[model samples]
Target chain A: MTSGLDVRGITHRYGKKTALNDIGFSLDKGLFCALLGPNGAGKSTLFSILTRLFVPDAGEVMVDGHSLAREPGKALARIGVVFQQPTLDLDLTVRRNLKYFAALHGLAGKDADRRIETSLEQVNMAERAAEKVRALNGGHRRRMEIARALLHGPAVLLLDEPTVGLDAETRSSITGHVHNLASEQGLTVLWATHLVDEVRGSDHLVVLHRGKIHANGNAAEIAGDVSLQTRFLEMTGGGK
Target chain B: MKAALICLVAIVHREALRFVSQRGRFLAAIVRPLVWLIVFAAGFRAALGLSIQPPYQTYITYEIYIVPGLCGMIQLFSGMQSSLSLVYDREMGSMRLLLTSPIPRWWLLFCKLFASTAISIFQVYTFLAIAALTGIGFSPAGYLAILPALIVNGLMLGALGLLLSSTIRQLENFAGVMNFVIFPMFFLSTALYPLWKMAEASTILRDICAFNPFSHGVELIRFALYGQVDWMALLWVLLAFAIFLSGSLWGYDPSRSMVRRKA
Candidate 1:
């Protein structure tokens, strides 16, 4: 199947220290894929390169058949990013943050308004749209970010360590909501995290460690017999 | 096109509200120069003599001499302040949102420049109004003439700040800006003292002062205060604006990958 996000022999470094080494993976369009890695496995680095915040040292990134190098704007337009931190301007209300993002995507006017409303509704953030970001809890902020990311109707949604500080309930609900979006709306997702349970058996999973891909396949297939925790521990060489 | 403008307005409006919200910044913008104009200049006026220049039809008080310099100071600080905000915005991820937009990088940077210039102009006028209140007033026609100079000056200073923001990489770098950039530029120029006085002190310092972009910037404002033109000053200020703006754009290009590793 054609992939939504493709990486071929991607390598990145920070000075003498290597971060990602010949990493190769592809996520099919409309797939709920998990980029699972240990701490310092270069997940965030990968995310930065993907978001065009940092250019990769070596690699090719294609989003929906568009080459990132050749047409960065188009590639950027095709993907939505939800960074690990709560990036909303605390002084701005949820609606204002959403509106700012809409403008980024060249979306405005009545169409932007409709899309903003629709995206907020999807994350159930419409009711709190007028509330300043500082007033919202962690889960609510993440929801707001999700709503903002969706405003542009991107084909690929990239979440970097998205559920870092939320309760298990909220985490699962957010994961489930993202999963549903992938299936129902054909939104390809590259959900990067260290959290084991966030990935389901059906979801595509890539295990990264020491700046290398350890394995790539269905989560259940790799985690078979042993728990995901055990497999992940063995891969990172950090488990006692 | 319309959307960008709306975003620009919202951003600029937010900055204005932020200025209103933080009363200290306003106080600082006006008070520093006000102190210089009234107390310091009154003391200096008797000692140092200034001949009539192009803008000044006759000899004026030292209070009036540095009005444009103070205006330049306002532009300089507002520009640096905008850079500080850019760093904060990067940390907060708002810059990411703007950069990731489908718009060209230059347009986004220009939008930021426009927003900052607008804020700087507001600060300039506020400073002028305060100056007028202290009997350091300009003619109403002069005030009208100054608007364009304020914009050009604000833009050049803002561009310098943008260039610094792109190059500095972190908030700690601001200390370096103050010591290495702001202080040197302010002190080295004919802001507090006349260039002829610097010539009296030392020709090398005086020659350097004569060539300072800030010297040109101040001249641009000084002439505007008298409702006249300084084409040389205008050319130098515009040249500095072009250079700094180009440097900022070069530093911020995504392909450079500074944001990736730095952040």
Candidate 2:
């Protein structure tokens, strides 16, 4: 069986400085994987490579059995991404934003409307669908972005620092929502962040430090006797 | 194929909606041309003399002579405005969303060019209508004939804008583009003065104006507005469009340093 996402021997560099060094990982369907890394750990560069914004120097990415290099369109069709920065048009309403995204993915008319509605409901933003994005709070805007990402019903969702700048309560709520998406809806998720508390004990955790993976396994097992925070600090050189 | 069409429509529709929401932009697009037609043309009518050009069968007023040039000006500014927005979008991260779509990257960039061209064409027609209301009118058939010319010219200028946007790394640097590119291209072209007038002053300046692609765009519009065709101008504009579009495509390729540096 094909993994939901497979990164094999991926390497990337900017000039003489390597950004990602032989990084490799995989996730099965319906799994929530946390890619925990501190600042300058090359998380953004890896996301850029995965999203095809930058081509890797070596290796390949497989998304739901589709090779990113050989069949980019098919691979892209299966992957939805929410970048660390907000991508919504602040002047446009919530529904209009989702409709625009849906149309980009070839959804139109009744089908587009249905998906927009469903996605908004998933994020509990259906009631505010008519509101302009500029009128929403930071947490709500993040929710709207998540809704837009899911409008095309992508098989794998990749979020880079999704909960950054949100309140602790909002962050936990958003994280809980995404975990529910993986568990109940059978969606695959790779959530990248520096927050250790966001990783559940049972979740798959991949610790990336200085462009290399230091640990990848069940979160509890990786933590072992120590707390996840202490283990993460040790793996990443005591937070440098 | 259907998906591509849908994506194209969506992009164009979004551009139109954004254009409508920014009333200041629409007003600026119209007022700039109108100012040239009403004020500068009036001031220069006595100083400059226009002979019987191919597009002009007889002596014409300065306003009538400069109308096509002003149309080109509208498109030129509109194209640059579109480029400025592209730079802003890139900085704001919306461009990443567009580039990561399932559709081909070239197709996405083309869609953006098409949307910019469509918006410019609409602005040109609106400017033309305002000029007609001011008693500077073209042949009835010329109005209909100018549509195709406007589209081609708009696309050529829009492609140039796309090329510039792909190379421009930040929004703050766009002012440099205006001073270095927009002013020189507009002033050095056949927009305000005829090539013959430039020749009387200096042969070198005249040759430079004649060689400018924007001059060909204006001449193409001028002839098309009089129910005629300038085949040379048409060919030159098309060639420039091809070159600019190709450069923009290369600039936007993922492997290229232009985009990689940004990443």
- How many Å off is the CA of B263 in candidate 1? 3.5
Candidate 2, residues A1-240, lDDT tens digits: the string is 789999999998888999899999999999999999999998998899889887899999999999998999999999999999999998999999988888888889999999988889989989999999999999999998888888888889999999999999999999999999999988889999999999999999999999999999999999999999999999988887
Error of 2 at B15 (Å): 0.7
Instruction: Write out the backbone clash pairs for model 1.
Output: none
| TM-score between candidate 1 and the true structure | 0.96
Q: Which candidate number has the best lDDT?
A: 2
lDDT of 1 at B130: 82
Deviation from native of the Cα of residue A54 in model 2, angstroms: 1.6
Q: What DockQ would candidate 2 receive versus the native complex?
A: 0.79
Please give the interface root mean square deviation for model 1, in Å: 2.3
lDDT of 1: 0.85
Candidate with top DockQ is 2
Question: With candidate 2 superimposed using the best TM-score fit, by how many Å does residue B114's alpha carbon deviate from the native?
Answer: 1.0
Residue B235, candidate 2: alpha-carbon lDDT = 99
Quote model 2's iRMS: 1.1
RMSD of 2: 1.0
Native-contact recovery for every candidate?
Answer: 0.59, 0.77
| TM values, all candidates | 0.96, 0.98
* Worst 10 contiguous positions by lDDT, candidate 1 chain B: B254-263
